[model samples]
Target: MATTTESNPPAKDSKGLSSLNEFNLEKSILRRGLATAAEIDACKAHKAKLASKDESKGLLEIMVEARVLTKSQSMRLLKEAGEANRRVEIPGYQVIEKLGKGSMGVVYKARQTSVDRIVAVKILLDALAQNKEFIKRFDREAKIAAKLSHNNVVNAIDAGDVNGLHYFVMEYVEGGTIKDVLDKNEVFEEKMAIRIVMAVAEALAHAHQRGLIHRDIKPENVILTKDGNVKLADLGLARLTADEKWAMSEAGMAIGTPYYISPEQVRGQVDVDIRADIYSLGATLYHMVTGQVPYGGETAQEVMRKHVDKNTPFVPPDHLNTKLSSGLGVVVETMMAKNRENRYRNPDDLILDLKCLLQGESPMIAGQKPDDLATLAEGDVEDTSRGISEAQLIEVAGYVNGKQSVIVALAAILALSVITNVVVLATR
Candidate 1:
């Protein structure tokens, strides 16, 4: 335990020296201490004279000297106030300190009293609480995040309101976020980078299958666990595909960080599907591999304006990193295509291609037309139960038999086409 004098020292004035006063006394000790109201009043009367005599003396010292508070009482009060200021005690949870802050709310590292488990608590800012739209989005985030149980998605535990404050709790991840890693200028191996993206892609596929669109997908939202697992977080901008709610932003207003905004998202279109996240994912990969966004501008407006312009071409990852594989460049280019139709038709297409690339096989991107790419066989596209494992593929293929195997066989055919194409590129 820290000494009272050390923990609650005298506050500095303009000259950086202690000046004994009522306000400082009240805030640091007197308000919660055993000091009587009359004693406090008495101290205020002589505070000015005491302060002038020795500007370096703290309020607590003056109070003790004037008998307004005994030395022991002053010490006790300092300790009490220090503890109170150190932690924010919400019902059932002890908020240790602030973990992170965002436009919507601030996240705190907290401990749940009952279970003694560490968790993250996000408290809505008072200004946003007054806005019905922000409240709606807050509530929607908790609901949607709670419903999702993917390994790569942060788990929402509980949500409640206390004394007009809205807060939601989630499982605390100790390893921090991808943004933290990128901020350090860390470079990732090609396979490791693709693996991390694959984890997020799988999570997106699950959410997309459930009709939820995560409008914002950036490095900051992706948390890395201690065991090298990825956990996508922050669903405040998520929206249900089936819900006909009013657009969060008005006409000509684009939402999401400009660094990873999709072209449709840049247009401020409210009816965007899962493809928007795919574009953002591609942008994230571009940053991860090349250390820069495809488009650059001083302001978000200028960056978004670049996204809206069809004439601006995307710079592939290889242009920035000459050592990167040509196949990886093709995958990034396919995902970041300005025209949504030209992008991966669905999350599965992206996931399939990524899995193929990870396995040292050619990715499934050849002469396939966008229209044909959009129509994936029924159960194959929406199955979020497992990943792109051979066993999982066999299980889905078993749903149909014999000649109908063409549905399952199509995935293999796509991979085979890419293999031939990759060989041609290698020869060149």
Candidate 2:
């Protein structure tokens, strides 16, 4: 589910430590200040206790009694005390709330004061900031992601380390991930599913054109806006074509989530290119349509072996829902092909076939006309050799943005309804 992005060099402050370093330093100073103030308070308490002939407690006992530090925080501080420290500052953005945590870092939802925009800021955990490999990878990925500009891809706004903490800011998507949607509702209708996959395919096409391969593509990494625009997030695991050695090394070590990895990736082959992404996308599409992963096993190793050795299960459109068409099944099968050569040659081709399905044409048929493909209608299903019509394509484009707005509006209504219901019930 992790999204891969290019690493960028850390931004240098006037004093030279990265913004992440500065943030960490500020955090450390605050912690120390709090500790020192507590100690002084404890000393005063001890003096009072001695004068009153009462027993006095140590600093640790006082901190515990006051609930100054949670068990996790205490453990983290103990670990940090064993490491070296450095400090730096980021201008314009202030971390308002934490979004999520990962092995390498924590993601926060921050407000960018300069533009008055909300952004997702990822900061390397203080513990990992000192790891040379993690720092290099973080910088490299941030830089690369900053350079990319694609509608379907989450845009990177800034990257830097403050004090010794590395952080990067990206566009904040308000809607939940595809995984979240699926968790709430197991599967989607074929038409809706195709629309989502097509958007992701467009994103992959853009990234691949930039010579970057998103080694990880999954439902969790794909976010659906309230209006239904699907934006690909998290490019943390992406590898640049230019960094062959490093990219290959990372790929060889099993880079993707086990359930979504391609056969080539599971085999330890570092030469995987766009085709690997195609396979992963196919698996993702399959899950969206059927609510089941193509391959299943108890462990990472077992799942990886299944990816390399086993064939995808029989997943006809009728298997999950009788309303799905065989054409949609064909598209999923083509994507999930174990052999890379048999898969869609590129995302462009995958998108083309999806458009074909939208037009109600048999994607299996040959000699489709580009013009005919471009002239179909929204929600129209027809069998024609030309694929999706241009008009239909335009309608799809309109739907993307329009649907997103609708989703947002619907969410607002739902929230209001919940609040009203709560108030009424409470009053009664």
Predicted structure with the largest lDDT when compared to the true one? 1
TM-score of candidate 2 to 2 decimals: 0.65
Instruction: Give one digit per residue, the lDDT tens place, for model 2 in 1-428.
Output: 11111274344333333434334433553545544555545644664565467554333334446565455654454344223122213567766544666777778777888888888888887777878988988887788887679888899988987666689889898888889867877788888888988999999999888888888899999998987688998887888767778755755577788878988888777788888998899888888877888777888998888788644354554466667887887777778777575677788888888899999987842222232223333333343454756775576568555656777899999999999999999999
Residue 357 error, candidate 1, Å: 1.1
**lDDT (Cα, 0-100) at 352 in candidate 1:** 87
RMSD of each: 14.1, 18.1
lDDT (Cα, 0-100) at 311 in candidate 2:
44
Those runs of model 1 whose alpha carbons end farther than 4 Å from true positions after fitting are 1-87, 247-251, 370-428
CA lDDT for candidate 2: 0.72
Would you estimate the TM-scores of all the predictions?
Answer: 0.68, 0.65
In terms of TM-score, the best-performing candidate is 1
Tell me the tens digit of each residue's lDDT in model 1 across 274-333. Answer: 989999999999988887878999998899888878667778898789978877888998
Clashing pairs in 1: none
